[model samples]
Target: MRMQLETCLAQAGGRSDPRTGSLSTPIHQTATFSHPRLGESTGYDYSRTTNPTRSALEKALAEIDGGARACAFASGMAALDAVVRLVIESKRRRVVCTEDPYGGTIRLLEQFFRPVGVVPVYVDTSDTRAVLRELDAGDVAALVAEIPTNPLMRVADVATLADAAHAAGATMVLDNTFLTPYLFKPLQHGVDIAVYSATKYLSGHNDVVAGAAVCRSEEMGTRLAAIQNAGGGIPGPMDSWLLLRGLKTLAIRMDRQQENAQAIAAFLAGHPRVARVYYPGLAGDPGHERLRRQARGFGGMLSIEVDDPDLVPRALAAVKVFAFAESLGGVESLITFPTVQTHAAMDAAIKDRLGINNRLLRLSIGIENVADLIADLDDALR
Candidate 1:
């Protein structure tokens, strides 16, 4: 019999022995593992290299992504850096990216990697022809995409882009932080590398800051491991253990969150004060058809274009339920203006091209009651 996702979440890496049978994985907080003899160490010589708790988390992650191996890092950027370091052979190279990626990713590419000669070319991935045209140029070392992209909810066909990247001899990397593995698995669709900001959906509580990378092959896994060891951004045992505990309830939390998002999107679509609603779950939305074919379900994020930019502050203040904040994928709903908050670092010209306007509000629907969430939005809009 095949194991269900919820079952995997509850018991994937669990060990229930009498000597160490604890319902929750214990945090192995020691700095080093003991070696009984002069030359024999028990897999972990030092905390920087490995720990039992961290190992357990990595094993769980690899299993979830259907990959050969996984690595945990101190932050999402660190995980991305580890992967990029594997391909940057010179300072004058380029990476192809989607037009609307997470703002921090764009900033990292422009500020850090650009100085080292790795330029990023942003294109509208929704247009397969445009993606093919850019890839055919042969300058791109890798292709990076964020399905259901941050704040915009744009869905990219992972298998199609992965085929293009592989045929061109470039790696296809995806940021799977938004959808999480519960709703979508990139490796099954041909992605060579999948990365995540575990701080978001994986952690599910907004308390821990961690990242992960899953490599399709053992050779790529070894390369990433070397970069992780040399770069030294591995997550501590406690954070890894916390993330592992959070993974146990990922399915339940996401199920409720998606239900709430669907309701909120419908409400916003019919509201007179809203100009437009962007959600992959909406039947006629731009990416709806492609999304239905790829993802198991529409995610818990949506964006609404307000009639007036000035109404944002009033609406935020009036809302008694939704919290006005940054970061997302928590148990509580969050609302923010992407132009001023998440995408502030993006250039004005690029922002205009991507349609991240001043009146666009990004809502991270949480695992709250659907009726309560809609009522709160209604009060705020009024």
Candidate 2:
């Protein structure tokens, strides 16, 4: 039966144990399992390639993404690296990507892929016509998009881009980390691959460090799994178990967090100190309508531009509730200055061009009381 996402998430690892009726999926932390016969196997040979905990996670991810299969990795970057390697095959070295993606991804492509002969072509994927034009100018191996893009919250029509990519003989890879499978799934829109930094909304808490990729077909999934095993960036059984634990409460956390974000975005929009607020949750946001169509909810992530760049430091230092930190999407709220922290790998000129400046601040709204979050920001802005 097609259970709702909430039901699926709540019962993330609720499969009954055959021997013990344990509600949670067993860790199966062993490095290797014993075999009875020399030429026989139990479909459980090594922990690196497969394990009960990781298998459960992989299944959950696939189910949520509506994909054939998924591969878990040590970090979000590792998952992205695997996808880049998977798509840029057989001399198709040129890949088109979102103009503003996670800085780490840009670093991976420029620092690593570029050095090894792979080239990255960046465009505002939200502009469908621009993307179509780029696809027309071929030699593109893959088109990677971060829907509701990092910090900026730009929305793109994934299905339209997927059609363009396919017509141009390129695969479509969607970074669904911002919205996650809870709010959206890229494969449903004809994307070939869906990637996530499971550490964020998927993990819910600020603890686990993990990544995931769901392939539209079993063949792509098998290829990604091989890359994961060969690259040795697989998540440990314990980490997989932690992600399972996080998934149990993901729906509730996201619901509350995005609610708080909507309230805060409203607060900031009216504040005199705010020059601009970038949150798709707001009806006035450029991406609001498209996001509504593509996602169940506008996510908790948003960015703000202060009228005075100088006040950015004051606001950071004054915040009593929001943590002045690097990462985001924990139960605790986090404030990040992406220009220096998250997107430091992006060149200075590109940062300026994209409006990722010192005046801009990114907020990772948590499941805090809506009033408290708004008050905290008001106090900081004052």
Residue 316 in model 1: shift from native, Å? 1.9
Q: How accurate locally, in lDDT, is each candidate?
A: 0.88, 0.91
Could you give candidate 1's per-residue lDDT for residues 250-325 as a string of tens digits? 9989999998999899989999999999999999799999988998889899999999988899998898889998
lDDT of 2 by residue, 1-382 (tens): 9899889898986773567878888988889988889988878899888888899999988888889999999999999999999998747878999999999989999999999999899999989999998899988999999988998989999989999999999999999988888888799899999999999989989998999999999999999999998897989999999998898898999889898999899999999999999999999999999999988999899999999989999999999889999877889999999999999999999999999999999999999887888899999998
User: TM-scores of all models?
Assistant: 0.97, 0.98
Error of 1 at 95 (Å): 0.5
Q: Show where candidate 2 strays beyond 4 Å.
A: none
Worst 10 residues of 2 by lDDT: 12-21
